[model samples]
Target: MNIHSVAPKRPDLDRLLIDSALALFAERTYEGTQMPAVAQHAGVGVGSIYRYFPSKEALGNAAFRYAKRTLLDTLAEALADGGPAGTAREEFARFWRGFTRYASAHPDAFVFLEHQQHDTFLDPESRALADELHRVAADFIERGQHAGAIRDGDAEQLVGLALGAFTGLVKLARPAGGLDALPAEDLDRAEAAVWDLLHRKADR
Candidate 1:
């Protein structure tokens, strides 16, 4: 008769809270989401959320890290499967597909991460995760440049440009049921167009 042991484990509850928070963050901006709302979404008492996250800012940071990590992992898996032997063009295609997969499966996370403002409360670890993604992408762009496959530019800027195109495409598709709603041909066209933005041109 150990009712305490039967209760959701701490890690399970933590994930439940974070998932609930992300869902609300997507619907209402992070600034607008309230603790009670998160508790309601998680199907737990308001006190339970506070038990795991000391403050709303703590929950927000956790949600940001979760969403960002999901994105990074998706990209990593795609690149890993393609392997080092692949050409930059091939790798780029894998990277594009990785983004599509992430966006399709976690559209709410994408909206939460992109639609909310994060200037005020992100902590060091959360900030580092954000920077890590930028650095990893810049490394890829630099390698492509060295191979004469990608255009010569500030690698960070190039990453921003490529992802900016992705962000725009996802936004465009969100109303129609997110990235998955787009036809395969449309996705391919968008992917090719984004590559054209980063790829080297003879005149350039």
Candidate 2:
């Protein structure tokens, strides 16, 4: 997506800080990654970090937003390239498979995203960014529903349920072997079950 070109003109102090924090947090849990360390890694003064993020929690939320945006951008590109068609279940599974590959290639970023999902005190702007990521998925869901590819139900609810199931599986497998815990074949099997749940009836 040409991050440098698309990003704001102002100094990317916040983004750099968040990227540094994510690297540290992946190596050591979030509790172990301190602000000073993040600042050092970002090559920014500690005061610069505080000027952008008042607290560690705020920094974590910013990292979460960055991770979500990265993932969503990947999904958008995959969909644009005609990755999948027909059903919401099919499309989402395609997007997710691509996402898993990206996550596997960048394990730390994946872990950071997982950590953020459990964090409740994220800043308002960070939460808004997270919500926007979902909006991308929700748009696909809504389109599938309109095309009679998805079952009749609340679009938001379906998206939530699908996301919950997929992430829950990842969370469970992560303990077994981190990002590589579940192989692509295994994930494909799991995706089949999730797809069955969301697919429209034949009579439709």
Candidate 3:
């Protein structure tokens, strides 16, 4: 009996493969990574990978979706309350903190997500999930704009700017050993700077 030909019977094994793939993808990027490397990293045979994912593209898409879903799930609780009356600023601040914390705690996932741009292998579900996340962010920006809190502009563009800024901050902080490496006061200052960029002049 060839064990390599058999699919992993345990869900945890699937998670292990996904997690291993995420780390490799984060370090080497999608194009640079290979299934054999991922299998080796996961301590599984190459055939085991194919048993779970038909091809390298499929595995990449699966890993991307896993990381994305994990991130969204992490934020769900923090964002559950939604924006209450007269609390747009507070809500945004809470969301920003939650996002930064998650990224810091899960650098591999964050890096993998940040690296996904113009990847043709991403499956339909992955693309849809990405679109949904963007829509959520754009909606938040639109709400802030209407409430006279955020700067007036195209909501999508504003979201891009905000996300770009956050991404850049994470990249810079990576050298310093993640967001948590920064002092609490420093994190606060960074968040304040981000808020200032988003805040309308009238609100400021």
Steric clash count of candidate 2:
0
What lDDT does the true structure give each of the candidates?
0.89, 0.76, 0.82
Better of 2 and 3 by lDDT: 3
Residue 47's lDDT within candidate 3 is 92
Sort by lDDT, top down from the best: 1, 3, 2
**Which candidate achieves the best lDDT against the true structure?**
1
lDDT of 1 by residue, 17-121 (tens): 998998888888888989999999999999998888999999999999999999999999988883573688898888898888998998888888776679788
User: Which window of 10 residues has the lowest lDDT sum in candidate 1?
Assistant: 2-11
The true-structure Cα RMSD of candidate 1 reads: 2.7
lDDT of 3 at 154: 88
Q: Write the per-residue lDDT of candidate 3 for residues 60-141, one digit (tens) a residue.
A: 8888888888778776666865555356678777678668867977899899898566367987899998888888778888
Q: What is the Å distance of residue 74 in model 1 from its true position?
A: 1.3
lDDT (tens digit, per residue) of candidate 2 on 1-204: 655756558977777787788899877877788889998889888999999999988888777777777887777776766644655666766777767666666667877776444455577787787788778777877888898888888878987787777767767776687557777788778878877777788983
Off by over 4 Å in 2: 1-17, 23-54, 83-90, 114-121, 179-181
Model 3: C-alpha RMSD to truth?
Answer: 4.5
